[model samples]
Target: MNRTISALKEWLNPDWARHRSVPPFEAGLRPNRRLDEGTALLPEAEFEPDDVVIRDNGEVVFSSGDGIFTLADGVVTRVATLGGQVGTLLVAEDRMIAAVDGVGLVTIDADGAATDLCTDAELAACVTDLTLLPDGIVLATIGSRAVPDWSAALVADDRSGRIVRVDGSRAEVVAEGLGWPGGIENSGAGEVLVSLGFDHRVERRAVTALAKAGTAVGTNLPVYPGRIATCTDGWWVAAPYARNRFTELLLDEPELLREMTATIRQDQWFVPRLRCPDPYTDTLQLGQLRVHGVIKPWAPARSYGLAFRIDQRGRIAEGVHSRADSDRHGVTGVASRDGRIVVAARGFRNLIEPQKDKER
Candidate 1:
């Protein structure tokens, strides 16, 4: 049969064979090697948080789907409602700036007054993340203006994402033609680092040379990088979804991927997802057929959660991981406070904090 011959040819190909040997899911595979052994989930809040930042007053500010909330003493208080899916939050002096999915960048005051910050037509797309610079400017990452569905954009290989700088009412594109720029941060010395999700790498560029091409920093990451945050020693990078062999193998089989995307429902497809509540509905993604009364947590996963710490030079120093069996998946953002690492576990819908050590 033609199908039999095609399988034989694929197995004979050296590259395909090597990649095929790498199992799509391993029984006890933890990429970070249990670096998150002591990490504990924090108290639940009213809504799921996407991003978190430490205010000048030491209060923690986070952006949920519908509003911006502040967390203190394990209590969450809604400070402002953006009326849209909030992506990222930044506290500049006394002002609270946020990037709303359906809306553009806006600044919110203490009394919940919202004012438009960047209204440039080009920057009105899905603003994913933002960071405050030392010079009082704000840098934001736009995923794509053409495709609202980020999942579709990734599979379609949409390269329309961009990075922009916002100063007062003026906005300028710093970099363009990016493949889903998910996170932005100041990388010190007037340079900025951005995480390109679909590209599976991080890039750095100077603020002055906005038109210049970026220098790749973290290359060929095993996971799709989401957000990057600065810490005392270096940077905390969030890897929302782990690498899967099926997705990796499809990188060269564009036609197959296109057919799958066209034929399958978006939610049922074998793409990385942020949340999966019903295990039965996700069996297809697990690359398995469900037998009666036989569901396992360690089932194969197309997505997992991971975070890593990188040095000032952008080299990975340490990491944390949640394997396929774990519930703590989809780590979209990370922050550090008083030596405690806080993670926005988007999949689990809870913030996670590692148990404090008395020695530190």
Candidate 2:
């Protein structure tokens, strides 16, 4: 497939190629509706964020699909195209780092030298989220997929998914069977907090026994919680693509509340895709065809962006990539350190706009 067409296909039918084997009826589900507020129209100008990074000295670094975007105090200073999907940026010790999709991690040291820190295979494992530990240990998510395309669905990917620890060439799986883990953060006590995307829950795993010992601390979040951050006190989980509304289940006992919450099903007839038979197979097969409550890209108020934060207990101190500044589709990658938000937004508006121009 041509690169442009393939990219557009990934954008248009995000779940098609990977979920082909599963029956459509089983695969598709109607989403539970929230109180339908009138559709909200955010200005297009506000949503045009490129691959960007921030430096410690108040320098804004960004790339617009082609070159580097130089900024001083949040104003664009220069622009240069550095080809690739720039995911997350890390500013450490006077240096800047950009995690590019497919091309491992790149670090620009103090003297402005850029170097690769990890390998492509290590990155292709889909390191959706990352966190830097005090002792040079970097925790990242290696998400699994039922079929490769299913991963595009932004749901479950448990089989091949893992929480990996990277300390310069020493890569190890600390946690396994994590469902499309979208968020990673370091707990103040040396533990790693991860968001189980498909499962809609938050988890904490000790750094040492990450492969084996870990437990789910919070459960039953409303929708897919993408980015997570931690501060001096508690935590913040962002449900970027959550149902438009939320409700608190006021139950007496925590255990009873947990049990009751687990029983709620957003789509009863939608068959959940679990795993694949072989590692190499990427196509999905549909068993049945059913369409109900399917989300359309043209629908208003259907934005999907990264949302999460870390703060004091019982109160959210700071938040991230607000719903006001998000796109309707595409995978959004998020990471934060010391209160700075690094975001990577990927989508295919280029293909659509050109066609619209032709018709006009």
Candidate 3:
């Protein structure tokens, strides 16, 4: 690990970002998709996939502004990306909820109504990820990730991160001091498990008083455990990388993790930024240079979409399972239940348009 970090440092040069190429969508100011006539599909139908997920029965749910597609065994069966850029999707009880970043949270009933449960303004109160808790409360992560200086970078946002609990129309702050909470889960026994992205740690909180329950057995396990899932085992975590590698952390070794967390405090040597900024904008100093460094000298570029085990324990270490090159663009976010895995690719290009008018 030390050698890798040293190598990265030695190869890091001021000209690194110059050779990097920023994606076309990210280089422009347009949202990935625009609602010209209230129709979901665009005229060109070029909006790419942002996220994906799996249904309870084994259907793969993938998102793109063009439509939401349901895949079975890597084959597309149904597509539904209309009226929103699907940022995240999760199975909540009998229905599914799809979060449309700056738009609003939509609850798709078994019949698929796509009812708006919470709008952009309501969610702006700080809800990033949402999950239905047992007792009628909707558990959500309400945190802000720092604006990255580079593109396609997997580092955590350190500015502001938090957790929230929303019951019907009421909301409450549950936890804070986290590095951009990305994924959330609730234990059957009133414990909420959260993934701290920047910190690369998992933590639990009690529901009653919203007090700190405990840090996950493992700490500093990986750079970005994208999502958290609960299964028959213990707790499952997914870590995505630029090499398109996905790793699932099995918490079955509770004793080993507990001991490791208690003693390990020194920060691990992490790779520096490796993405190029917009080429048209020379204002972003050394942005392109960094990209050149990562591709030319640092190493071949790779990205991990998502990885995790069906069971939370060591019973089965599900290898990194996801589409290759899925991380090339907007792909991120994953959730699993039973024997299924759901991947979500958020369209970060056009989060929300300034000209978009709120429904009156």
Candidate 4:
């Protein structure tokens, strides 16, 4: 059987010796129109949000290149301008902390006064997500050190991603050689759950033993997980993009991947984006597929949007999706509070509140 399987692999992917393949989306992560059933909770805009958090005062805010902004009474308002693009936001003790591009992490208080927390030279960029541990330590996932951004890092198969711990003015890398650690969250049990994008799994590690790669809580995920926020029962995880079999095949052929990267426009690369911007040119004609809303990729939606929940023990709870054919792609952030769920469909440039939202 082993020989037959190997022979089949050779015959199917003859050009590549590596056995790279896409994980199945079954069980709790199955595809559905749950996200499409959702309503646009916030007014449409070009904010290009990365993460959103419900403040202690019951204010809804999100992180974007334009900085932190609040949404209330169906109106969006900027609360602070951190002087650079923001990656993630965390609310702690009446103040908000954000990962600002080129500036490290900055704390914004009630008055929107921005103060630098950790300006470590290494973490000046590529900070993916942030979470506060029970012991007050702040953990951050550095997507990669080899590339300036995620697209380049994934294309180059970069493995410099790390988990950094921040204590007041000190910041140090405790875990290294990660596969695009895109999301971080505290486990209420004193452990931390990290979503490994390239590895396609969620790992659990002791805050003290982060030097270890930890154990898998969820493995062989179908989507590249992103920012995760604690929910009433477990945690809500965002998937900015979904896996593509063709892309996986392309990845196994390094020479071909290299040549394509060199010759093709970055925008047209077989990579995921916030949305299928130019339907005509996008590997998939999502625009044309929407007969009234349906279909996927000429290739899959490099524009897939998804979010799921994992129980405290890392068991899959439930999930939702925008589908490759849908414009609601790149769901990078999710927050649930006061019976209301807010999802940042960054690709769609909108926030979604599923039909199940009780508050609204």
Separately for all candidates shown, the number of backbone clashes (residues 3 or more apart, or on different chains) is: 0, 25, 35, 1
Q: What TM-score number comes out for model 1?
A: 0.83
Backbone clashes counted, model 4: 1
- Comparing candidate 1 with candidate 2, which one achieves the higher TM-score? 1
When sorted by TM-score, best at the front, the candidate numbers are 4, 1, 3, 2
Q: Write the per-residue lDDT of candidate 3 for residues 168-234, one digit (tens) a residue.
A: 5455666665666667777667777676665556666677755464646445442355556665556
lDDT of 2 by residue, 147-183 (tens): 3333333322235567777777556666776667767
What lDDT score is found at residue 136 in candidate 4? 73
Q: How far is candidate 3 from the true structure (C-alpha RMSD, Å)?
A: 15.2
- Provide the TM-score for each candidate, comma-separated: 0.83, 0.56, 0.57, 0.89
Check candidate 1 and list the clashing pairs. none
The TM-score that candidate 4 achieves is 0.89
Q: Which ten residues in a row have the lowest lDDT in candidate 1?
A: 20-29
Q: Candidate 3 — what's its lDDT?
A: 0.46
Local accuracy of candidate 4 as per-residue lDDT tens digits, 1-360:
655676788889887545667767777777777788898866677678789888666778988775789988788888899868898999888888899888898999989889999888766888999999866788999999778577888889889998898998799889999889999998866688899998888888887798787899887777788888988788898989887776777776678899989999888888766787766675532233444454533335567778898987678877877765568788989998865678888888888876662221
- TM-score, structure 2 vs. true: 0.56
Off-target runs (Cα >4 Å) in candidate 2 are 1-54, 61-70, 77-83, 145-158, 232-236, 243-301, 304-306, 310-360
lDDT: the better of candidates 1 and 3 = 1
C-alpha lDDT values of all predictions = 0.73, 0.46, 0.46, 0.81
Give the better candidate number (1 or 4) by lDDT.
4
**Which residue ranges in model 4 land beyond 4 Å of their true spot?**
1-18, 284-299, 357-360
